[model samples]
Target chain A: MKKLLLSGMLAAALFFAGCDGTSDPALPPSSDFTVTFKALYDGQTLEKFKSYDYDTYKVNFSRFNTFLSDITLLKGNEEIKISDIEWVDFTPDSAFGNLTVSVPVKFKNVPDGDYTGIRIGYGVKPELNAKRPNNFQSTHPLSRENEYWLGWGSYIFNKVEGKADLDNSGAFGTSLVYHCGSDAVYRTYTFNTPIQVEQGAAATVEFDLKKLFTINGSWFDMKIPANQFTSNDVGNVIVATILMDNFDAATTVIQ
Target chain B: MKKNNAGWTFKISTFSAVLLIFLMLDACKKDDPPVEDRDDDLVAIPYNPKSYTIPKPEIFPEVPVPPDNPVTVDGIQLGRRLFYDPILSADSTQSCATCHLSSGSFTDNKDVSTGIDGIAGRRSSMSLLNVAYVSRPLFWDGRSPSLEDQALRPVEDPIEMHNTWANVLDKLKTHASYPAYFRQAFGITSRKQITKELAAKAIAQFERILISSGNSKFDRYLAGDPDALDDEELDGKLMFFDEGGLLGLPDAQCFHCHGGITNTGFSFFNNGLDSVASLNDFKDKGRGEVTGNINDNGRFATPTLRNVALSAPYMHDGRFNTLEDVVEHYSKNGKGVSNEDPLIRQLGFPIPGTNPVKYSGLTEYQKKAIVKFLHTLTDIDFVNNPDINNPF
Candidate 1:
């Protein structure tokens, strides 16, 4: 046993020494490249026109936050895998109004290879996302972790929550909810301009919230409908698709 | 002649002394064999640490306590008594131990848990073991963030304990034994101090003591015990870790959902259970109700796989009665739902042309091996613990 131990140690030492003498240290080489992805939104109008009186607007985005297993870096037509994409929710106050969720993506350990474009999605995959409870941190808002108070919704790729005035009803209400989840909430955007990216780095695509309401030749008005945004609305699906489109266009290649 | 006789006697004395010394040395060397060497043939007897004595309190991510509700010896003692006592119930006929028995892995061994008045709950009662180390959200739907918050839900639910906070507090305040215990745990004797909030905190503190992640067979092997597991068990562990499916797929993808040292990612998943009928047929709307997203309709939180060998009737609905059944469910790309996750579509084993299903690639024996590895997670100490049992 003593001989075996000694021989094993000697063999390991020799093997390590040989490798150290022959092979160079594998430090990731840095390079410069631009990564871009569009921040798309629907050109849908708000309900009651010319009303910004409320402190918070609840935009009912279709559930697009779930089913996100990984986020990728798309260059032109090719997809590049980036390991680090941390999404943070921005709350104006304790009431959790105006949820500004940001996904900070870094392309760490990628080698120089690029052409055009960028693509990223929210949430994991289906087999993972299924059979779950709502709310990000814990089961209840009060029980949630201090850092995860904003709660991570499970639906991926679409958000649909906002007040809209149908044919000028003239009743004003405030809403800022944007629900995005898995079911039928999907979109694919082909960018006009292709973006480039290199290895060992990453870039982010930040979508502007205000532009999401005003993009399609109309302004987002505030008006409440009879129904509180329920789980199975087809309109939520449309809203989710438009957001995916907006994101695809809003992506700017970072150099 | 006398000189020759003296030399011969000296030589004989030296030889006898050398032999005596050798015998003594051999006797000292045989004092005690290693504990492992003596019990090398013992099967299923864990490589228990000789140093292990007391059960350490496990620290978990969620179960919060107000600065006032810190865990103490008196508090744990009082909570353990209360947990075993039926006084917390409306009729005083059933206690927390009725459903959460220690022998049944802290879960009532039934498909669905029965509450006060024999009311059936929407879901099965989950095991309370190792809950302290859980970083994932609580409950089947991931609702109710902390254990303190979760404790109150079962109490208030009409189907559960059937006792409201107002009544529960009043009962505890009036009880002869409970008031004194409460006074020791909390520094107050008044009914206001013994509110439902205090009850939740005390119960949560006690639940935190029910930590189970200890020296299991698998843990022993991982901790470098060469003889912790038999050959077959070791092979199963290797197959479970490797991407090659064990039974149906190329590698037992059990590691994917049930990963990490504790096992189970605490993530939510739909394992094709809800696709049988209408999406809303189940009571839980999953993440959909919370996010108001239709896509999250059938999702539920993944339970910890620690002690999974003992905790049967797996899945959120408790539909799969056995571990093998659960494996079979995942083998087929979970009941095909429209917008079924792409990851489910990708399940497959290394060996080709077994099932012809692209994703689920495992062999029959590999599945059994993976199951064998899972059995090693059972900690006998936890199963036979005297402290976590009925203190009252």
Candidate 2:
């Protein structure tokens, strides 16, 4: 009986040793999970040249890439931070995979519990935004090729490139290129939703680009001449303001 | 007693196991030393220390130097020789100074510089005056990140020097003076260590010394010389600075991009050069090609206006033959493009009893005054400085 009891205690100690010391007797055991992000346009998954009716014109996205960083899960103010930054490229030829419409961000060793909400920064955090691409590790999202505006001394937080046909001429004549950046434009998005994360089960979140572009019962008119934004103060501020206003309403937790 | 012995043995074995695991983990965590630290592992060699201090002109900002490649007297001298020596070329008939002549403010007078093979380059040579003050991303497109990186490109460019770095290295290794020069400059033990990196560093050191001392009329005026500038020049300064309310003159809108002592912010802009329906319609992608971004199409780095009078055939492509042509282009504003910078769009003065016209915001007299003010930035002492001259 004594030997059996000693063996049991030894096994329990061995099991606890493998953990990172964050395990609590009151809480459930930690587990691995993933948060999958989806990009949608007009309530449908993104497709190039898929005509989306706006206020006065039809729009189609040829390219869309955004930097998402500082992803955190809040369990009643108990912050579970993920030290990973991801660049979600919705373009057809994205290196993540061909025809991949959704990006899955994995979280390991997460304390299994009920998360009140998830907080994610839309772009690089302000502290990390000032650093140039060359300063980051080559594989880091901040080190993306052609994403940094060297002259402007900032990284393009989001790139939404496409065309618009104002007159419905069947030809996408008007070019829409909104390269948004600047430390002043970095935004944080919080989704207030109950998320029951079980051990080894994945939670999903969806980013609806359609809702993001919609404002006041009208779609954002990319055909506006001034809307062809760059990294300059006036244009970038205009585009960034529109994006921030619509982002909170658009994002939703699917699971 | 037996139970006590068994407990002691178990405790000792468990402690040994923990110690073994920690040792293995520590061994696994060992990482390679940093590149700079690894250099110390090499055999030591006798290094002759020689420092080169760059003269700071009151008009310009403090020059930035790379930590790895410190300026040295031997490095600058070797770089000066290499700048003028045709030995770096495939045919031994051309050098960096061939295209960047000191007389033309380090720019070839031709619209496009001709190489050793007489093949013309796509873009005109840029002036080297006050280049040390330029921050990251050199060249018209802002591709190369440093002057050291910029120095290595022309040597191997097919239309330029047309020589491989290996061939150039071999030539330098065989040369009697270069091996010793490399030794003194970089503290290299042998000629084999004389690499393109050291060569480029030397060249960069020499380029850093090319500063525009505050001897120009504008510099004198800033130095509290009340009569340094004439009334017309002062009016032009006001127009350039766009202090219209204070000077009671029209703003030329030049200070939006070309402000400060360096006369440029060194940022890239489309400047409304082309009116293409699509972003892909640009002839020379400019910064767009370097960045691979469609929005950056037709954008080029803003060149400094210092010594603009001497550096003729301006613009990246050298389309404008003179400063007047440049002034005229700005006066008309550029052919508006879709990606044209907002700052470059529709700048003009309000005509009497008419809607504001699109063009330069300056009147004809204001344009002349602005041109005269630009001439005040010409530091003849900089162009004529003998220290930066070619050393054969």
In terms of lDDT, which candidate is strongest?
2
Q: Considering every candidate listed, which one attains the maximal DockQ?
A: 1
Per-prediction TM-score to the true structure, in the order listed: 0.54, 0.58
In the range A84-154, model 2's lDDT, one tens digit per residue, is 57787665231222232777767777777898888888777777777765455434666542465533456
DockQ (Cα-based) for each candidate: 0.05, 0.03
Query: What is candidate 2's CA lDDT for residue B111?
Result: 83
Compose the digit string of candidate 1's lDDT tens values, residues B212-293. 6467887777566889998778767765553222232244445534554556454555555665455555467775555454
Q: Rate the local accuracy (lDDT) of all candidates.
A: 0.53, 0.72
RMSD of each: 21.0, 16.2
Per-residue lDDT of candidate 1, residues A1-255 (tens digit): 999999999999998876632143574343543333323233222221123322244233321222223455466555655532333332111111223333343444454555365444443344434423222223332122221111122332233333322323332122233445453454433333344444434554544445644536444343332122222233344544455445444433354
**Model 2, range B1-392, lDDT digits (tens) per residue?**
89999999999999999999999888866765542234432235456768877885553445667778889888899888898899999999998898888888888877888788889888889888877766436788888888899999999999999999999998997786787777778887767677898899998888888777789998898777979999888888876764543445755557545755567444666776667877799888888788776766787877778888988898888999887777767665555454555455333443444312223266777778888988998988988888889776
